[model samples]
Target: MSVINRVLRDLDQRQQQQSKGSYTPAAMAPQPLHWTWMIGIAVGTAVVIVILLNLYWWLTIDTDPALQVVEAPVTNQPTVIAATAEESADQAVEEVERGTDAESASKPALQRGPVKPRELVQVPPSPTESRTSELEEAEATTEPVVSEIPTETLATVAPEPEAEVEATDTPSTFAVERVQLSPNELAETNLQKARSALRRGEREQGQELLEKALTVMPEHVAVRSELAAYWYGRGFATRAVAILQQGLDRVPQQSQWQLLLGRILERMGRIEDAYIALQSVDSSSAEYIDLLEVRGNAANQLGYFSEAAQDFLALASLKSEGRWWLAAAVAFEDAGEPAAALRAYRQAAFARDLGVDARRYAEDRLQALGGS
Candidate 1:
């Protein structure tokens, strides 16, 4: 009874001591977030978005070899000239009258079939398109057939005054006027007439018309070129050279004239002259690539393999074609530059963007160059 009383008294004293003080709650552990942490989270999120966008672009866009980066069409085409006032008027009339091109004039305006020209009434029908109509008319009419006249008798027949009057009454196609038209107008008219003549297959007449145009506008480079081209296309290389030479004589240092002359000479088989002429041509010409190719050909013809190789390489830069690359490689081989030739051959072999024949030729060259 003495031990139990002692233990009970100690427990009651401890309970009474804790009841006298205020009760306190447990404290939580500290967790801190600063500005730097927020910034790092934002930056990480932005980086992830950027990476995803780049991946999308990579999958969607594919650049092809034949793809071109087009710019605004502002390059000066020196060879082309604007249409004249007369030509513009003609075009406007043609448009306003038919709401179409010149060919519309051949169609009937108020009939179901093609228009029959009214002038054919007083004039005999041409042998070309009206032959069937003429034959049908002769069969329909009961006109008596005259006796067959001998060729000699027809040739020896006296000239009729009516025929002479008709010949004299025929209107001239063009009446040249000194002051009625400006120099440009004169040139343009002649140029148009020349083109029409060419289209009509009157080669000699076309040449004459172009020459007349050149005479009217002596300083006109385009007219000069047209005349030169007219001769060149007809296989008159010497005549083309002469025309270009005359132009050059009037004004030396004309890069176009020189370039064209060089081309003509190259065609004429005057290799040395062509090389010399081409060497003097300015690099700023509109057809710089053609000049490079022609000069390369000239150099090749002149046995200047090193120069030819360089020129062909420059041309290859202008046109990324297998044929140009192959030409450069061949020129390099001729110039004893095996290393450059090998590189070019490889490029040409892999240049599938070029023409079929060019790729085939390049592959053949690659095989010949001891490459797999």
Candidate 2:
């Protein structure tokens, strides 16, 4: 059994050795890629990279050569279209020096070609170069330069005779003429001046102006009213009344005149005259409140208790004052209207703004009238 095992082991060792000998190693395998092929590939990739880099550079480069050049002239310098007179003179001098002025000038003028338009160009010449170019231009034209007119042309162009404008005595359209005022307008003007003078304390001047206004138009209500107001303020009540009456005689429908007259008469203690003057005053007059107050007092003084009560009630209706209510109650009591008097007394006694004496009087009146 041992001998057989040794033979089998020997056979296994021989089989292993034959298998090892039959298999080829990686280092001994056939090479698919050579160094030359790798070198060639590397070279081609490098060339391709260089070409791409160059192509990118060409595309990204700024190729405008004019943008690199500095602007020769200031941007603000005015463009020089034609040469100046001095340049023309210099050109003329040079042409005379050349001895063939007509032939040379005519030749250049005939040989010159049409000018072509150029873009993205800056041809601003130096001062000396400009002068030279002007001289060349002068030599190239046989006709007179822009700055000089030939003697023949000047002689051919005669001066036109100027027309003479004759001076005439014509009235100016804008001259201010004196405006002629009518008598009424003149009176109004004087009245305004009188009022202004009175406001300034020029009493004598104001009176004179007022008189002048009345003289111009005696029927002038406004002038008469102003004069009456002035006289009334100056303590000349009779004169003021006289002036207002004169206005009323002429313009009887003027309610303001009547109001002023009534106020003056009432102040002068002429109660009957005041009542008559105020009777004609319209309820819509601006002096209606004054009329109510003065007429009411006048009526009460003259024993016209019913009219006085009506006036006081109207005033109460207008202002809702406790004093007015009390006045209304007293007038109603005197006029024999106990019901209205009692109601008015109650209102006065309970009034929000009643005076102490007024409220006490209202309470006594209410108690007398048997009101709660």
Candidate 3:
């Protein structure tokens, strides 16, 4: 019985020792990995991936400047393009001219129309007509080439200014049709023709041309003067008067015309009419001296002694001649102004250029007026 009990005790002791060796404490047990270690591992993996990608890109990229592409610079100007187009058009025109010359040489039998010059074309082959013919011929031979030109280029090359162009519809080819003469110009031409006719002794033709000139331009001073002189020299005083009056009526501002009219009226004994006509003469006129003399004479004839004296005094101041002073004295005496007449007589009596008869007349007037 003691031996069996001792064997049970040994077996129990062996089991207790085995249980103590297998059992682990909770504080000493192996725990799951921390989240911080997991986060650190993930970040390290991303950094390694980025480094590998950069190394791959560096290895694949090209580093040579020689293989780089180049592009042309851009411009916004339309004139530059137009200049290029003009150069192209010049080349095209030269080619067209060469072809036309070749065709003419090759087919002498082909009756080609005469090639009108592009510079100046007239008559039936008017400038525009010539241009159209040229364009049509050029298009027939080189339509594809010309068609490549821009519409702007075509517009630039086709039309011309009207002044430089000639018309073909009119039957007459007179140069007068091309040029339009102004009224003054026509009158001038007529005046020249009349002078030529007069020189050639063609009286009727000269008269006709002069009349035609006046009809064309009533205010033509040269033409009117020429016609008036022509009649007055031919002893037709009335005709000269009419022509000059007609000119004055059209251009009253013409001082030369006024002077001529006054002279003609005075010559015809129309003193009153002549004085009135001469009143409009400008003081700045080349005919001013002539105007004063004629007006003074006409004034005396019309009993306007004061006006005559004033006109003669102006003439004396300008001419410094004793005859003018004597005339002024006579005018002043007629005007009933003895003081002014005496002063004028004194000037005339001692004048150096006064004629013998004039100086004696002045002295006699001075004595009669109670002056020394």
Candidate 4:
């Protein structure tokens, strides 16, 4: 057989064999179906579907319900809080008003009508009271009165009018007496007279008399004070201060000497020392009242206003007349106490019959201070 016929014959034999028993068509073949693999595939597909369903639920489900519980609205909160706060405030205000009303109601009532006095009624004593009074009288009357005989007193006695007694005036023991000075005091008096002469510009005679008086009593405080005054009149403050200080040392308790020293120190511009000397005087001493006045004036000039005010207040308490009130007003004003100054000025104006001026000044100051 030729090669082509042989090949065709083998292909027909294979087809015949294929058409015999145990042969299957392509669309209806008894292929070896892998049950395990199909089952595994179905299970995998089911797992994937289930996973996708779970993922969709997880991704799309609403979680607002869970959050809503934590963030819920507070119902009726504002209205309730406002009502409670308003009620508390009203209660507090009502309490305050009640307190004020109670205070106002408790004030003393004024008289609305004329007052009638109570009538006095006298009652007679009871029997027990009369008996007790009689018992007390009986116990008190221990002495008996004696009676004169009527026959002996038969003669009539003429009655005489009583004489009037006249009061006599007696002289007061405190009347000023002419006191004779001792030799030393007289000499010191002469020295003061001479110093006065010098102060009056009689220099030659004053120097002569002072020299004579100094020869007599060299250690007299009056003489020394007068000499210091003379030096002060001559404008020798240092010498005046030294002499006055010596006199003060001799008579430490003498207000006149201290006043002189203080004056000299003040004139010399020794303010602190002057104040010290002036403050040594006792305010209650009648002897130093004049000296305290001088000190107050000096303090005023020195601008020691608080000190001046204190001194003026003391003088005011003494009821001093003339310039005391004026001094007090100036001192108070300089001390930065405008209210007290105004009061002092008012008192001064009233005292000095300058009421209109004082009132105007005080009113102006008060207005400047936004009114009292």
Candidate 5:
């Protein structure tokens, strides 16, 4: 029995040893980390950072209602009235070196607001009133001003006083000293820098440079126009008007400056002043079309639809845009000239530059007036 037990145990041990020897464990190998996936993750992170930075830069200049311009006031700049003719001469020399165009009329994207028809005062005074003085007669003989805007609109356009502001306190921190610096060169450099900054979307920096330029040369027409254009594009027509008005003080007969001022006044619904400014422009000037547009807008705002229609028709003759024709047709309709309106509408429908909505308007007007 002892011999049989030993034999059975040996048989079991031999079988276990055979199984262990046959199944030699394969050597374990470590799997490599996915470097390609890690690279993809790093690239995606970089792209996200770039996008975030760009968005931040763009939003920095956004004039949200909650944000206000909080620039530090420059303490050392000379008063605009105190600015000497020598400084102006220096700036003019600088501009000449830079080859800046004196008549550069590059307009920015204009800001627009609601302009409703206002009641006009009488143009001619009644002779039977009383034995008034000559002064009274002259005052009464002045052309009627278009100034019956709603109270709310008037309130929104207040706070201009630009020349007053310049004379009292300049708005920026980087002030220039009249006696301590390289006058014209400094101003030119600043203006060039301002243009560069604006092109790069650095609005505040550009604005600061412009303020510096104006400090050195308050009546610098190009600098004033550029600065005014910036404000005008930002919906501050009063600010633009004030700046340009200051420019007009220096060069009262400057046609380009007057044209821009007229355009701004029209946008502000100062129809009478705008019309007068437009009338001052020569008909043979290069800006004839712009003058027409400005005069037409002013006339339209003052409820002179017949005059507006005539101006628009002249504008249509200059440029074959459907929008102009459409505007002319609407003005004609307002003037109670259905035939003229229908002719303009038909012309508008066939223009290649015709917008979908403008086309629809022309068709509808034509249908209503019983025209093809």
Candidate 6:
């Protein structure tokens, strides 16, 4: 049994030796490739792949070189807009000042007032009227005899006053009583007497006499004319003009009556009618020369220099002397026509030295016309 046991153990030891000899050093150590190492390498490789993909996406997609992006300034939009708008406002203000100076040079200077010129017309006295003296004689004669005085006889009696009687005449001496009065003339005398009484403060007598005179000759021209003068003296110019105009129509050629009518017309502010009446008188007639002067002066005052010139010229022709020539010259100057004015001034200067005033006036006008 012992011997069998030793042999079996030796067999077992031999079997063990055989197993050790078969095992190499590489087999005795761990295996070179393990499951855990393999898993760690796989995870590291996946992490590397993910990092490379992220780097590629960042480089290729996030940056673009072709697009240009501009950032706005820090200022507000309205402020930037205002800065741009300021440059356009300065160009509109320079065009308005040049149009006002060209309009003032085209008009004439002002005249202070209307001017008067000189010239006039003169009417002569008629040769046909009955003489004042003849009327007086007829008034004294009976009606039948007065009627029997021939028209031819009446026409032959000169109406003008006698030169001798005129030289001796005075207001008192020439009173209506000196020559016998017609009924009409007597009524005029009474009216004049009434005016004188009124002027002397004898009012009741004046009124009574005027009433009696009017009763005797209701429409007598002399009586009406005297009453008209009385009313005029009392400041009733309108009534005076009415009466004098009627008197003038009845005796159109009586220069004395016409003179009174002109005066009444002037007093009534009927300037045109006054001028016409004044213009009707003969400048050569001694009775109306004073009236001609009045008419010329009135025409001058009213700016009717042409009418004044006419009056002055008529007066100058009648007198044909120094002062009258000067007056006519002045009238000619005022009426325009420097040539005519020059001729008139030469005539005046030739008549008498007009001093510096007339000479200078003529010289200035002549210079204006290129005549001197």
Best by lDDT: 3
The digit string of per-residue lDDT tens for model 5 on 1-372 reads 999999999999999999988987688688877999899999999999998886674344221211223344677543232223355445445544332232123322222223222222122223443234334545645667897899999888878589877866855577776665565667777889999999999999999999899899876667888899989988888888888888877767566777889977876778798887665556777777887888898889889999899999989988988888999999999999999999999999988899898899899989999996
Show where candidate 5 strays beyond 4 Å: 1-190, 193-219, 230-239, 252-276, 282-291, 355-372
Model 1 scores worst on lDDT over the 10 consecutive residues at 61-70
Provide the TM-score for each candidate, comma-separated.
0.44, 0.51, 0.50, 0.41, 0.39, 0.41
* TM-score quality measure for candidate 3: 0.50
Q: Is candidate 2 or candidate 3 better by lDDT?
A: 3
Give per-residue lDDT, candidate 1, residue 98.
44
The digit string of per-residue lDDT tens for model 6 on 154-252 reads 899866679767866745554465666677877877888887998899876886787678677766655665666767777878777776676667666
What candidate 6 gets wrong by more than 4 Å, as runs, is 1-185, 188-192, 207-225, 282-285, 298-305, 320-327, 350-372
Model 1, residue 187: what's the lDDT?
93
lDDT of 4 by residue, 1-372 (tens): 699999999999988987896677678657896999999999999999998886665433321111112234657433122223345446545544553464347643331223223222112236796576556555555457777757646555433434322222344366788998776977876777786787798987886777567667656766666667777878888888886676666567567678788767776788778877777786555557777777887888778897898788777768655256666777887789877776666566556544566656655655564544
The predicted structure with the larger lDDT, 2 or 5, is 2
What C-alpha lDDT do the candidate models reach, one value each?
0.74, 0.78, 0.79, 0.65, 0.75, 0.62
Error of 5 at 49 (Å): 99
Q: Candidate 4: minimum summed lDDT over ten consecutive residues — where?
A: 61-70
> Total clashing residue pairs per candidate?
0, 0, 0, 0, 0, 10
Number of backbone clashes in candidate 2: 0
* lDDT by residue for model 1 (1-372), tens: 999999999999989888776556578678888999999999999999998886664333211111112343565432232443356446545433443333347554332333223210122235663566555555655468899999999999977799888988998698887678888898989899988988999988988888888988887888898898877888887888888888888987587787788877876778888887777556777877777888888888878988998888887778787777888898898888888998888888788777888877767867787775
The 10 consecutive residues of candidate 2 with the worst lDDT sum are 59-68
Question: 1 or 6: which has the higher TM-score?
Answer: 1
